[model samples]
Target: MKANGPFKILALLFVTVLAFYLIAYHTIEGRRNRNGPWIVAFTNDLSGAPALRIDHPALAITNVQLVFPDAMLPTNFTAKTILFQRPRPVPFPLPMGECIFMDTTFLPGSVVMRMSGHEVQLIPRVLTINGREQPWKSGETIALTAILTNAISPRLNGR
Candidate 1:
């Protein structure tokens, strides 16, 4: 035999690196793509989540009619820091997973927008309208529209 000690050592090292890359490395990469914190709107339809009627006395909304004056709503993206704010924020960024739905319906895992390491998840809760100082009921089938945008980076907004 030719006593290929160096070759065996190199081969073993390569295998070890491969295992780390394939098993341990879960793509916990940098925050280069973070652009989120979108305040989106959704009804109480689980099919098109971002819903807000799951916790109300009524389990569904009726006679729902949505309208968008500009055919789009803007997304609100915040800083991508560990100091996140919200209820049931997504642990990962967008493109990984999200909720997408039409102006009048709901969709699950369709990420309306994202920030740092969290996402704007729609759930059943009383939402306060700043303009009217009104609190939206949990199961009310109000006409609504949601538009996703990247306030931080317009390029990511995708026109």
Candidate 2:
């Protein structure tokens, strides 16, 4: 029985490590599945245009609200200016008439928005409009200004 003592201790230690690994793996996978895909909606309040409402089927959490142009400025404008600045981070919920820049990616798939002066990035798994699904491929960027101009110019011109 003396020889079996060390063997049993070694086996117990190995089993404990295996169990810990399995638990960690499952926990990470669960969190990733629950988090879902990231979505971003950029809206300009000064433009006098309707804000786009973005929704995802798997988006369970409503993230941050980022204000643009101001967020992109390099100088100490926030200190000189008299505007309440929220923490700049990846925005998820589409705040009405307030959001100007929302981004998700860090590099390679960066998109620059002229009005906001900030890069708008997204990892859109599925984008929809009026409850109809729209096709959005990976690394694709949409220009909000171009869409607005194209859509509104004709109406203003009475064409």
**lDDT winner:** 2
Model 1 residue runs over 4 Å out of place are 1-3, 26-66, 69-159
Clashing pairs in 2: none
Candidate 2 has an lDDT of 0.38
The estimated TM-scores of all candidates read 0.26, 0.32
Where does the lowest 10-residue lDDT sum fall in candidate 1?
101-110
Cand. 1 TM to true fold? 0.26
The TM-score of candidate 2 is 0.32
Model 2 clash count equals 0
Candidate 2 regions with alpha-carbon error over 4 angstroms: 39-55, 60-118, 123-143, 146-159
Per-residue lDDT tens digits for candidate 2, residues 30-146, read 654453434444343353332222333353323322333232333322211111123245332233222334332221122222333223333344343223444554334333332
Please give, for residues 1-159, the per-residue lDDT of candidate 1 as tens digits: 457988899999999999888765454322211322223333324333223221222323222222222222225422221211233543443322243321211221122333222233333232322122233343355333444555577666664
